[model samples]
Target: MTRAPWMAVIGLVACAAPAERSLTADPGAETTPVRPTHPSGIWPVTPPGADSPDTPDPPGSATNCDPLHLVATDIDETLTTDNDEWDLQIDDPSYDPAMRPDANTLLQGYAARGYTIAYVTARWDFEMSDGRLASEHTVDWLHDHGFPLHGGLVFLAPEPDHDGDEVVEYKSGVLLGLQAEGWALDWAYGNAETDIEAFLLAGFPDDSTFLVGDRAGELEVPGIPNEDAYTAHLAHLASVPDVRCE
Candidate 1:
C-alpha cells in the first residue's frame, strides 16, 4: 500500500462527484435508508426527534447511538491486489481482475453475520479527462467478484466539490457523514496510512481500526509477505457481536 508518486496528481482529479447512477443489486432499485433499531437486551431505542446530532446519545438512542455494526473498508491493495499494470479506462482490456485470495470469503463472512459493508475508496468517481464513470465499473467489479451488492452495501467516493482534498480528508468526511446519518462504524479496514488517519478522524477507536500492508497502525497486518495476517483478522472479527439490523 505504498503511496505512488502519481497518486498525488490523481488525487487532484479523483474527488469529483460520482455519476448519477445506482450500484445496488438491481438496476434502478431504490435505496432505503437504514433505520435505527433496538438491540435485544443491549440498548433501548430512543424516541423519534429526541436525539441531537451535536451530542452523543446514550447507547441505543435513535440518533447517533444505535450500534449499526457497520464496517468501512478501502478497496485497491486492501481487498484487491495492487496490480500496477491495471488501468480502468473503458477501453482497457485488462480492467477485470480477481479479488485478493480469500477477500471475498472474508467479506461474505461479515455480511453473513449481519454487518453492513461500505466500500470507501479514493479512486476517482469517473476519469476526469474522459468523463467515464469509474463507479459503474467498480460496481461491476464487486458484482463479478461475488461481493454482496444488495442491502447494506454501499460504495462511497469524494463529492464533486471535495474531490481535490487529500484522501484522508475525503474519506474522513464520508465517515463523518455516515455517522451523522446514524450509521455506527464499529470497524474500519485499510491498507494505507491515510486510511487509518481517516478512520481516526471519524472517531473510530485505535483498537477498532485494522491496517493491512506496510504502514503502521493499531493493528498492522502483514499484507506483502503473506495474507495470513488478514485471514487471522477475519477470524478475529467472527467473535465480535453483530448489532441490530433494521
Candidate 2:
C-alpha cells in the first residue's frame, strides 16, 4: 500500500470530564513491577523519532486523512485480561499474561484480510518506576504473546503524568495523529467509557465502535461480550474488503 502524504495540520480538542468522555480509566495507572531497562528482543527497538507528537491543526479545520482502513483498540482489558481486579498488569512480571481468549484469532484474521491494526493504549512512553522507556517491553509483550505485529503499530501515551483525566484527550490525539498521517480509522475497541468518547471525538462512526466488558452499555455504542467479541469481530471483518498500507 502507498503511504498517504502527511498533512501539515492536525486537530485536537481539550480534555473532557469522565462523565462526558466516551472511554474511561488508564490501563497503566495501576502499580506494577518496573524493570530498570527494557528487555532485549528480536523485534527492532522503536526509534525516538517515531515518538514525536503530531502538530494539531486549528479547530474545525482538521482533515480526514489516510486511505488505509485501520482497526484501533485498547490494550488493557480490551485485548489482555492479564490484569488484577483493577486491570493493570502489563508492567508486572508475574502476570503470566495471555491474549484475551480469541484476541489473536480476531486480530490475525483482520491482518489476513488486509486491515491494519493499531494498539492505542494509555501506557506512558516514559516509565515512572525505573525511568526506562516502556515501549520496548510493551512491544516485546505483544510479540511474546503472538499478537499480530507485522502490519500494526503501538501508540503509547507520551507523558508520565497520567494522574489527571487527560487520557480521553490523549487517546483522542493519537487517533487524530494517525489521521494526520493519512490513515483512516475504521474500527475501534475499548473497555472504558472514555474509549467511546475518544473514538467518537476522533470521528469514528457509532456502529464502527465497539466497547468491551461491562462498560459497553454505559455509552450508546454497541457492546460485545469480552469472551466472545473477538470471534464475533472476525466474523464481521469477513465482509469488509481487504485494505493494505504497504
Candidate 3:
C-alpha cells in the first residue's frame, strides 16, 4: 500500500485535536471521549467501559499487535441511499437515511471472518443541536441500523462542507493512519470518485475497490462497479483468507 509520510499522518492527527481539546463529555449527553493519541497517532473510539481497558481485543476486534484484515467504507451513498439529509439530521438528531440493501449484511460477513470495519466519512465534526458530535450520530445510525461494530471506527472531517479534493485528502489521511498503525486494509467500499481517489491514494488495488450508487459504473474511476448493493460481492468475500495473528 502507498503509505503516507509519517510526518503527514502525525500532522493529520494533530489537526483533528484542536489546541483546546476537551476530554470530558458534554453534560447529560451520550458521548465518546476523544482520547489522547497513542504514540503511533491512532486512538481507539470504542467506548472505554464496553470492554476492560487492560483486556486484549477478542479475535474479531482490531488490535495493533496483530496485522488483521480491515475493510474501509464510506457512509453516504455507499452504505445509505440519498444521504443528503445531513443538515436535517443535525437539526433533528433522530433523522436517519435508509441503508442500502445488503450493505450491512455484506460487512457483517467480513467482520464474522475477522475483518475490522473502518467507517471513513467526509461529514464534519460539528455538534448537533442535541449536544452530540456528528460522529455520534453516525455511530448511533450504524448501531440502530444493525451494522457490524466489532471494534470498528468512525472517521469524520475536521470541518464542514468538504469539496471533492478535501474529502479525498481527509479520508486518505485516515486510511494512512490506520496503515501506519498495522491494519491491513484489504478491501474498500465507496460511492464517489473522491472515495475512489482516496482508496487508491491509500494504496488499495483497483480490483479491491468497489463503488456503489450513481458513480459505481463510471468508466473513469478505478473501482469495481457494485450495482447490486453488494449482494454479489458477498460470495467473493467468502473466499478471502481470514487474519492469522503471529
**Residue-pair clashes per candidate, as listed?**
2, 13, 0
- Per-residue lDDT of 175-240 in model 3, one digit per residue for the tens? 887788787879888888889889989987777887777666673543444456767666776676
lDDT of 1 by residue, 1-246 (tens): 111100111122223432222223233445333222211000111112322212343333222224555678887777776634234434573367546677777777776666667677776555634343565556557766877533333344444444323777877766776677567787777877778888888888777787776554334432332355455556775687755333
Native-referenced Cα lDDT, model 2: 0.57
Indicate the residue-level lDDT of 205 in model 3.
76
| Top candidate when judged by lDDT against the true structure | 3
lDDT of each: 0.53, 0.57, 0.65
Inter-residue clash pairs, candidate 3: none
Task: List all candidate RMSDs to the true structure.
Answer: 11.5, 11.4, 5.5
- Model 1 is weakest, by summed lDDT over 10 consecutive residues, at 1-10
How high a TM-score does candidate 1 get? Answer: 0.64
Instruction: Give the lDDT of residue 198 in candidate 2.
Output: 89
Q: Model 1: clashing residue pairs?
A: 15-163, 17-160
Point out the worst 10-residue segment of candidate 2 by lDDT: 2-11
The TM-score, computed over Cα atoms with residue i paired to residue i, of candidate 3 is 0.79
